[model samples]
Target: MVFLGGGMPWYAQFGCGGGGCDRIRYMKVVLQRVSQASVDVVNELGDLDPTFDLQQIGPGFLLLVGVTDEDGDDEIAWLAHKILRLRVFEDEQGKMNRSIQDIGGEILSVSQFTLFADVRKGNRPSFVGAGKPEHADIMWIKFNEALRSGGVAVREGRFGAHMRVGLVNDGPVTIVIDTADRH
Candidate 1:
């Protein structure tokens, strides 16, 4: 099968081989406004497991970041800004007028490559749209650093590792951002 985009799996269309995802592939971030959030990182290498209680931010965000091969610095920078500046939290007037920074809130970022799962062909999901581990890992770190540099207190799950993420979605406010749509 021939997948129209780059980096699509051979089974994506009808007759296809191997290549990277499309140049226009998007970096996805799933954001949920949260009253509380935490993550436990399990040692997949069978070494030691650690749980990060992190800081107790009464209100904040839980971000599930999905990176694709085509995603890079521009995507990262844009996403970081958007997440930090998004005005989902309510103000004194009960209006959605406060950014995370405005409310002194924290951020919990988790690497979620599965966000790119494609199940069009069968019940099994295909991760062909996700970036390779080596590249994705670097991008993940870059994203966290970017958020920190933006003055947002950030906590993270172990990248490329098994993690137990728990959160309470405040206001049940959820949003999905895709880099492709921005362009």
Candidate 2:
């Protein structure tokens, strides 16, 4: 995925001004092309659960997504389609020429509000740029659905929960997408 035009876009706008998700209008996502990936939810007692549908994926993407208060359908749509079409997987010629859709890869999406962590002030990271659950949840649902609509299997980590994630990065091919920088 080429930073902006491809891959899943998680939303969270660090306002061009102000504090705490102030709304500059951009979503952030980190996509890691993986040979295998799995995410387990942490139960109320803080135990990791590996039995859900998201137990494991053979070859696919581990999508860490975030969103802001102002993110909407347009951003979601654009990113999903790009993820479905971006050609990063190897083709018959071993060239990075096949898309996830072409290879029938799955997606393990996890809500990652920390993508917006800001440490500009001090040693501690500030999460002021993360969107609130109410709005971000809706965006998360739509983003996953949008990926599923493209004909790939989609799995998810428990939203807003403490969990353990594991993956074997393929090609170590990682991508970072920020809507503000892209479009």
Best by TM-score: 2
Please, what are the lDDT tens digits per residue for candidate 1 over residues 19-107?
Answer: 43343458999999999988776676754384534334457999999998888999999989888899999989999999999989999
Q: Which ten residues in a row are the worst by lDDT in model 2?
A: 8-17
After superposing candidate 1, which stretches have Cα over 4 Å from the reference? 1-23, 44-57
In Å, residue 107's CA in model 1 sits off its true spot by 0.3
TM-score for each predicted model, relative to the true structure: 0.82, 0.84
Name every residue pair that clashes in candidate 1: 1-13, 1-14, 1-15, 2-14, 2-15, 6-20, 6-21, 6-22, 7-20, 7-21
Clashes of 1: 10
For model 2, residues 85-183, the per-residue Cα lDDT tens digits are: 989999989999999999999999999999988776779997767889998998999999999999999998888888789999999999987777556
lDDT scores of the candidates, listed in order: 0.84, 0.84
**Backbone N/Cα/C clashes per model:** 10, 7
